[model samples]
Target: MKVKVNRHAAKALKKMLEEAGAEGKLFRVYVTSVHGDHAHYDLKLDTPTENDEVVKSDKEIDFILDKNDEYLDDIWIQFFHVPNEEWLITNPSKGGHHHHH
Candidate 1:
């Protein structure tokens, strides 16, 4: 899976990586029940030794999917501040935070 990281996201992620002295880890993207209907994702520093495929981005690292995550095909990750200091993961087709009924 490919994950795009903007300047803010890259800087933030780099800080965490530098602190741990770990590099070349993929930016894992997946769906969890946290958001319901595969809306939630946990993007953190994952080591290559732990995963099979690791994608290194110009600005960030992206993890290769074990299997195709069709829902994540167009997924984009960005960092936000005014809305609050957090990573904003979005699915252009699904919209935001609305639980599936």
Candidate 2:
């Protein structure tokens, strides 16, 4: 499993982790739904379970992913603030279709 976080996302995620209640928790990227060749993903604060793999991003933030889900592998987490603040999660290995959150 691999996770990549863009510079903007890394900064935003760092702020999220600094929130008062986020202590001891890491970001978890899970499958919300699958659409044949692609899938939707969402993020949450969570700890690693036995079935989860903690993948470290370029920013040194850890992300929890399900070990058995191919859709969870090679995920790219990005954040943009130009048009509006939002999260864009995509799997380049899957098809590179952006899933917004």
Candidate 3:
């Protein structure tokens, strides 16, 4: 798993992880659901995980995954604004997106 977290995303994630006492844990990224042509990603900060396929950015607290997500190699997560302003996650490789705005 090779997870890359953008700077902004990293900052946001760090706050959440630190509060949960998961600072050193690598953020685990996985596909938790799929609807039609889209795959929904789930994030977890697991401790001393035995999984070697997970990748985390040294500059941020987010992950890029290989654990059952090898097919999503080119998957990109982007945050966008909509409605009253919210972050949107997009997966170009999967050909669809789910708005969280």
Candidate 4:
């Protein structure tokens, strides 16, 4: 299991954590639902539960991932600036799926 967080995403996430007073909280990325081969992502600041994989980052943040979710592996989080500023979460392991925003 691998999770990569880019610089832009790390900065943005730091700000979010600071603003929400959620420092030291676990940044959890999980599969909210799965439709066929596509899986949706959900992020939240919460406590770690049993059977969670902790991903390491450069900053003082804790990333908790469920060990049971194979679909959440190899996740790449990046901030895009083409059309607008938004966070794009892509799972290269899961073929491809178009997301309309």
**What Cα-based lDDT does every candidate model obtain?**
0.58, 0.93, 0.56, 0.74
Every candidate's CA RMSD: 4.5, 0.7, 3.5, 2.5
Candidate 3 RMSD to the correct structure: 3.5
Error of 4 at 50 (Å): 0.9
lDDT of 1 by residue, 17-56 (tens): 6775466654566666444444766565555453344555
Better of 1 and 4 by TM-score: 4
**Candidate of highest TM-score:** 2
Which candidate, 1 or 4, would have the higher lDDT against the true structure?
4
Per-prediction TM-score to the true structure, in the order listed? 0.63, 0.97, 0.62, 0.82
TM-score between candidate 3 and the true structure: 0.62
lDDT of 4 by residue, 4-53 (tens): 77788888888878875685687788777788987777677877888898
- Tell me the lDDT of candidate 1: 0.58
Ranking by TM-score: 2, 4, 1, 3
Candidate maximizing lDDT: 2
- Which is the winner by TM-score between candidate 2 and candidate 3? 2
Q: Which stretches of candidate 2 lie over 4 Å from their true place?
A: none
Query: Could you give candidate 2's per-residue lDDT for residues 1-101 as a string of tens digits?
Result: 88999999999999999999999999999999998899999999999999999999878999999999999999999999989999999999999876898
